[model samples]
Target: MTETHVPEKLKAPVLGAVITVSDRCSRGEAEDRSGPLALARLAEFGVEVAHPVVVPDDIDYIRSALQEALDAGARVIVTTGGTGITPRDNTPEATEPFIALSLDGLAQQIRLAGLAATPLATLSRGLVGVSARGDRGALIVNAPGSTGGVEDALAIIGPLIGHILGQLSGRTHEVESADE
Candidate 1:
């Protein structure tokens, strides 16, 4: 596996979470592949998965999972599922309240990257943002529920993950050493 090389300025490795948001998956009615798939991809990007949560499509459940991940000091949190137009699709809504700043480009890039494969990619309502709830808030991003979607999203995000998290934590600049 070719590991992603995070910039030198980023000294700390990413401690991350993957939250699977689907009512069926949450209830054991459907097999979840996206969450686990995303976690594996993240490993190649040098993000250490610290939490993996499965929550229903309900807004509260999604928010609770995000909150728990943040409390655990996750620097990056990626959620899959519930990003559609259906009545049960509430992941974006669930995420908005917790976000202090929006990273619209992250979601847009995912959609744009997938557009070549499927025009329906525009229908996803996923979001990306930062939550300043802790001392070093987490960078939160959402991806489509399908395994393919997770693959595409991760491929696009892998190169940018370190940069975004470094910015979120104000650590993009390399710290000077005593002799350097």
Candidate 2:
């Protein structure tokens, strides 16, 4: 597979993880597409992706996977699936406790992008945030369950991820916008 060259000049050591949340997928009743897609996208940006994991819609299981990934030195954990309004859609709720700071702008930006494509985007309920797990920090982003939704979210997220990683790692060379 060809890796997509990042636009930024410097490639920092960005570690990442992808979690797919789906009952059927986890039970081997259905194939997991979102997880692999997210992992591939992270790889394109030169991130060292930890072993991908898939869990059911259970909140406790989701939280466990998240904590394990963060403890393993993953700076970015993107979760796909379970961000909708269905009875089992509880990813956003499950993720709330881990987030030290909410990255509302990212969630909104991704939703708006998805909204342009389909009205279902408004109901995705995907959440994004920063988690200060002990001395380290990680950016946790929630993506929709569909393969296309994950692809659309990645199109907007991929470019900005480098900056987020730089901020998390305290990179002094970071270039901020004039307004900031």
Candidates in order, TM-scores: namely 0.85, 0.86
Score candidate 1 by TM-score against the native: 0.85
Off-target runs (Cα >4 Å) in candidate 1 are: 1-12, 133-135, 172-180
Over the stretch 1-180, how does candidate 2's per-residue lDDT look in tens digits?
334444452266578899999999999999999899999987777667866699999999999999889889887889999999999998999899989988898899889988878998989888888897333788889999888888877876777777666666675453445565
Go through the candidates in order and give each one's C-alpha lDDT: 0.83, 0.84
Residue-level lDDT tens digits of model 1 in 17-79: 999999898889998889989899888888899546899999988999999888888888899
Q: TM-score: which candidate is best?
A: 2
Please identify model 2 stretches exceeding 4 Å from their true place.
1-10, 133-135, 172-180
